[model samples]
Target: MADTEPEKTAPQEHVHTSTDYPEGAQVEIPQGWMYRSRKLGPITFPWYASPQSQLVLVAFVCFLCPGMFNALGGLGGGGQVTAYVGDASNTALYSTFALVGFFAGTITNALGIRIALSFGGIGYCIYTSSYLCFDHTQNFGYSVFAGFFLGICAGVLWCAQGAIMMSYPPEHQKGRYIAVFWGIFNMGGVIGALIPLGQNIHTTSNSTVTDGTYIGFIVLTFLGACLAWTLCDAKKVIRSDGTRVILMQHPTWKSEFIGLWETLISDPWIICLWPMFFASNWFYTYQFNDVNLAQFNTRTRSLNNVLYWFFQIVGAVLSSFILDFPGMRRTTRAKVVWCSLVVLTFAIWGGGYAFQTTYTRAEVNKGANTPLDPSDDYVKMDWTSHGYIGPMFLFIFYGVYDAAWQTSIYWFMGATTNNSRKLANFAGFYKGIQSAGAAIIWRLDGLDAPPPYMNIFASCWALLAGGLIIAAPVLLMKIKDTVSVEEDVKFTDESVDDVVAHKIGHEAVDQEKV
Candidate 1:
């Protein structure tokens, strides 16, 4: 595990036939238009079967689901007239999400990625529809129920998403693949935010989003659910290098449960990641409710939401360049990202503190000092306000910090292993722990005397700083230059099928060539 030692690596085998594949394995490359290469003159389109293409598909899957979900979150109070119901719903959602996500990996392996992902896509429609119901009737219970149901579905959906996004790419391409996925996924946020910005363009008062907005979300999420069935099975996927993706035999229910425990024990260092995961979602309530909603009009909040997610794309792109910088050692890349995150965390949160000092949620609620109408004055910063640019830029930086933080975590997990099965479990644990922390914070945010905005800002800064500190030892000592097939094979119950053997000699290409 030391940084200087040679990392474990699988030996190369130059195979030339299907029979050469390890026995009892149907590891043949998938045959279909999507899986076949087409040459139109000199240009050859990459096969849809390629890892890069599959990763792009998976990214769109999230773009339609969680990407829209992020848009709703960014709208503050889920685009409702008040934050109370939204806060209550998120508390219920994360509570169930924490419990279900911990076991979703076992469910994913037993069900297979495609089936698990299909079920995962179903909950967003339900969650989005509940908001529509809330719009018609003042029923908080419906939103809470929808949130709880979506949490269960989200648990499975995200674990499946993480498995594909993390396990599909070659070692060096992990960061770029993650950035690609993040960019596409957050595009859902960007477009989803536009729905309300355009709808509420002339309305400056605090009010609920129209039925048209909720209906659009429901339709998009439903389509995203249907796309899950199109994903290639994990075992049949071949990398650009003609090596098969790493996956073991189909898992039995009992074996999956056992693998979950093994995933933890086999790599105890994963515990170091728990804190960072816990802190991952901790800032949402503060950024969404406290800053964007409390200080901006309805249309302005929508505009800021657009900018927030847009900058997230920018942030993901920048981090990928640093983390996947060519010819750098994986550990050195890890250190570089870590240092950058630490510096940004301090600088951005410090700005957040200064902004927090300028206004209190209580003052915003009562319309104490603003010159505008009481209905609209709960917000101080407006799209037309003279000093609006300062606070707007602060919120934008928050988005950038968020993307960088999340991309680094995914890259770290991908660096940790290449096995789809193990990566699935790792993804589940990450969501579980992350939701557990989110549940607590959301509950706190919903309280009668929710912690002061200042307290929320300080806690976010402390948790982020502390998480980096806790993660240092693992980054310094445990991360390897590369993951090997043998290490992944030991984590699962079955040995690797060595499915890389195949007579696709002409298709084999260097990683750079791809």
Candidate 2:
């Protein structure tokens, strides 16, 4: 059997100075059974074991898992009658997500990415089921409890995802890969949103989603878990150009923690981006509950949810082109994105502020002092009502803003390192901090005297502007054209230095110390 296998050959190195390496670099096809099984006459189908294939695999997994989760979340109040249960559930979910996410990489390294991912998928299933249980029994505690457990699972799963996404692609292709993954992941949201929109199309009253929607989410989420097991190990994944994806040998709990600590202390610039991380998921509460649920009836919320996720795909793809444009220098691209986000944040949030002034929770929900005049046209906004187009578009813009904001952050993190082990830690830190902010905001929203709607809107705007401002110096001055060999060698052991240094041409090896 061994003698019949195709012969393997040494892959020649193709060197370039910038992050974008030239296409068509020669690669010797591997002799392994997995690679050979995928071959045809002139073209090899996407081999299950290849990095590109694995990326596609992971993207689908996310599309099923978190993507579906996003759809449910985007339904405003998790498709519940009122926002309280959803708010409390999110508070529980993000609270534990913060703590576990910070150390999730350790679990990923110890158990391997597949196990972590499988564990991650479990949480979504439980969470959606809890909502189903709530629909039947009116037992909201189960939902909050499910949220707490899911948070832990999500931390590990997302950390694994970030490491794989950020490290799998060659330097210049990172942005494209992020966009592709994001587009697919958010598609889950689009499709999931459709489930509710179609099911409740006739529902004009304020109400919770039917049990069938939750069941659909649970089944899709379970399939994502099955997909997780199919992912090729990081070490075995070969890139299209036949370069080995970078990995640390013999990973252990001790080594993973040590590397995490070193990454934090050595790369102090990451601290500057904490505010940005904190602000990333902080606005979801306001967007979903305060705005969408507050303004629209059940059926209309479902329709708005679909548009939101669809625009997310649009925003992710658009940002990728700007970030990965072949003509511009990588550093120049970073600066341009920073400037654009600053402007976009102000413009979008300024519009959000204006929208918030028109209706308070009292006015929209028809609480005290709110007369239910038939001609008021301010309460219980339905999709068919007059003046619906403007608010709908504004909500869509918010979706785009979310996708671009998240894509830029991932791109920034990927710019700093190529080592998967080190990147795992970086990703963990990002999720942890982001979850921390989310937890605080979600908890606040659940409070009896929660901040006024305008105050919440204003805080989101202020934090976003401030986070971007804080991140500007690092984006402009610190990001390099490519990852330095020294940073890789210094963070990981010396074993990776030669391989990494050679992959990123010797001329560019020491260009940046980060």
Which regions of candidate 2 fall more than 4 Å away from where they truly are? 1-46, 365-378, 484-486, 494-514
Q: In lDDT terms, how accurate is model 1? A: 0.82
Which lDDT tens digits does candidate 2 get at residues 127-203?
A: 98988897778787898999999999999999999999998888789899999999999999999999999999999
lDDT of each: 0.82, 0.82
Model 1 alpha-carbon drift over 4 Å, by segment: 1-46, 367-379, 493-497, 503-514
Clashing pairs in 2: none
Q: Return the number of clashes found in candidate 2.
A: 0
For model 2, state the Cα shift of residue 121 in Å. Answer: 0.2
Tens digits of per-residue lDDT, candidate 1, 290-383, equal: 8887888789999999999999999999999998999789999999999999999999998888888998767776743321123444445668
